[model samples]
Target: MNDVSYSLKVFKQIGLLKPVAPHRLLGAGLQLAKWGPGLPSGVNAAAKRFPKQTAIIDDAGEITWSELAGQVNQLTQALKERGVEPGDSIAVLSRNHRYMIVAIVAVMQAGGRVLMLNTMASRSQLGELARREDASLVIVDQEFLEVAQDVDRSLVVLGWADDDAPDDLPSVASLMAGQPTSAHAKPSRHGQIIIFTSGTTGLPKGARREEPKDLKPLIAFFGAIPYRGNSTVVIAAPLFHSWGLINFAFGLSTAPTYVLRRKFSPQQVLQDVERYRAEVLVVVPLMMQRMIDLDPAVVEKADVSSLRITASSGSALAGDLANRYMDLFTDSVYNFYGATETGWVTIASPTDLREAPGTAGRPPFRTTVKILDPDGREVPQGETGVIHVGNDMPFGGYTDGNTKSFAEGLMHSGDVGYFDEDGRLFVSGRDDDMIVSGGENVFPRELEDALIDHPDITDVVVTGVPDQTFGQVLAAYVVVRDGASLSEDDVKQYAKTHVARFAVPGRLMFLDELPRNPTGKVMKRELPDFE
Candidate 1:
């Protein structure tokens, strides 16, 4: 098989499927026989091959491949009936649930580009994002109904409503019920999934990617990470973020038994892993920490031994967290470093983590990693600089024309890090997250890494809080372990021992938990003003 054809085959493996309809399965067979690069076509292949396999197990319900394909078909037709033409933008705002997955797949199946909206998006951000994009239709969940109240009712679709109440907004369930569960017209080409950045600095820009031209890099990633091909998988990360969405997309290609929980609860994740016998567990750093926070007895009893891979991304996976999780869960943690604009830059396996506790391992196949200084010159090994990624896969540039500058032939990653002597990449901090403390440039990660080792601390986010003396002084927001107690003086003294005095946070505040985006990145702007 050629690259594209092989890629189509990989797409067929997208999670597991089961029988729901014989005729529809036959149709799926026909669709696969005339396979294209579209995701629906992949789903069709899986529906035919794994007709009796379980596809999705979510809070909404369990579904066989037959049921999933039928739902996608129904929604595809419903969307077309609603005047959603191929290539039109369809936005989705919901948590991690079956309907959210359905809306995403159906939109693309209908040849519409799916724009995933962050569930935590504020009303103004939603309005602005919807208005700025070419989205004429938005599929929103009931929890965010109030946020989408102003959307044209004709273009609005309720994705997941708890009560299934009759309302002006058209319902996804109603559409699926009214439409037939079978194949629809072939989608226009599977357009890029437009994921928006967290936009901590400004408006979130869409990082679009065309259909991957080459499958080698992806294949290498699969080979490198212990994903346990074609096994039961549990994804706790929100699909809105790049890390989660990539896994979700890849899982669809592999057709595994996909278990999703709409909201994340530490204990519940362990339960799902045990119940589903999930071999591949995907999480963000925060979720991993939360899972570790569960009672030791509860964790020990939870049978997560089926897990072959516990991949994490979207934020720095602290060395302490990695070691603790590995100690508890048998060294299955894999940490990745990258951004929304650029795909995976590096992936650190358990061995890499064990060797260099926080190293973001070397690049996989067909990927180039470079750390360049302000002058665009490659920085010396082990010197902090902006990260740039060069992969054969085309980055479907931002929709708003705000693209990052390319160094040589690579896209700038906006992360400040350097490669280790052994060629492993390590991210120190974000390019813009640096602060000046007493005339010295300080990266929050310096202090964060220093404090993450403290047993009393659960999680920490260090940000630049303004100070008259230093222009920008360091501030830290910390979450303590259950029943742990520590004073400001205690933390300050501990900070003094680990990092330079200038890097020590001048202000420290304790909280039950830090404010984090769905992807687990701490929202620095949301940090409390303790001064």
Candidate 2:
């Protein structure tokens, strides 16, 4: 056998193929090595194990494992030909598509950093991010090409039947030609990926992921859960987000058939699950509620039989909403109490979902979580405190002088919450977002949850508004259900019954809709002033 083939065989025989205990490894003993970021190696392994199996399926087309590897190699060569080299940051501003995945892998293979820009982000915002990172190249689709037209960097326009291509833009496929696939790709650790915070509080800050020790815990946590390996996963969230990238990495390493949906629509999600026979789905709570809000006929029509696991992150999952989805799929929904800086610090599993619907599950293997007071002392169980996690947690401070954000070693989640007797973490609202009225501490999430209980309330954001007498009073910006009209008095009355009186919004503004960022997170900073 050739040298590469012989090495791979030796690696597999030693039990590197599967994540198992050292003693459990099979053939050759190579001292159980961890697989770091090596796209070529990953592609090689996937090709060796499942050459005929589908690697990625998107609107553009389906690619088998073999094809996927070849394309990545070709793309890597193409990128190198264009002067893109190791350690260069390449910003990708495009929607979810097969090419996006191929591009990401290829960038990694070429030892280039992948800075994923939200396609939903405004052109100016995209340009600012690219400029801030000093990105070497920008890959954009037709829809967003206009946004990057002014970006002072080389561009690879992903054609999407637009009116006309720019003078210098080249067809994406044509870029790859006679690339050397045999060249050894740099390790995953050699490349870094920066995920910027979704700035609801202020301007976004970049969080650079360096060191394999910095990301393995996160990537490993996803691999350990959801019924072990050899499971199919569905990507409903945008690839740019932490949740999306985690699932994507897990899918790549586990060799799971990853099914991608270009954009999330309730109907589209149902159709994709049925079409791909997906065993797993990564969905946010809002998306779940949207599906639940649909007619029962729609739920009955979508065949979700292949689903084995439903994972929820990026936001809290309401008990009723969690129960509703669990009933629909007969699969428990898992939630992780995590942030962009730290990944899966604590996660609630299927059983946890059924029993403790609101609690984000227990800490994953080899992860330590501490609920601490402001002074950093560990708080007793059931006492609300900030969630502090460590796995060499990656909030090495924001690039924009936000070092105060990370206290000691833990990335101060800024969220307040408590652990139950079972050690499950329940997240409260952000420390800043908490509402204080008449000296009573009130979490807006609790108020928002109670408000959602009302049939007419479609969406609501509770904030502490300026109050002359009370310093700051509870206020709410509510989006009423379509065709239903309600006054602040009605909402106040409804909330009084469900939540504490002080927690009720003393001031309320009825809005057509709440301002949301690209990921559906309510932009509380944009809320107008209300008495």
Each candidate's lDDT (Cα)?
A: 0.79, 0.70
After superposing candidate 2, which stretches have Cα over 4 Å from the reference?
Answer: 1-35, 38-40, 153-156, 159-167, 177-189, 211-224, 392-397, 400-408
Q: Estimate each model's TM-score.
A: 0.91, 0.88
Per-residue C-alpha lDDT of model 2 across residues 209-295, encoded as one tens digit per residue: 553443345333553354435556777877887777777764554666777767678888888889888888877777877877777
Q: How accurate is candidate 2 locally (lDDT)?
A: 0.70
Best by lDDT: 1
In model 2, the Cα lDDT at residue 326 comes to 79
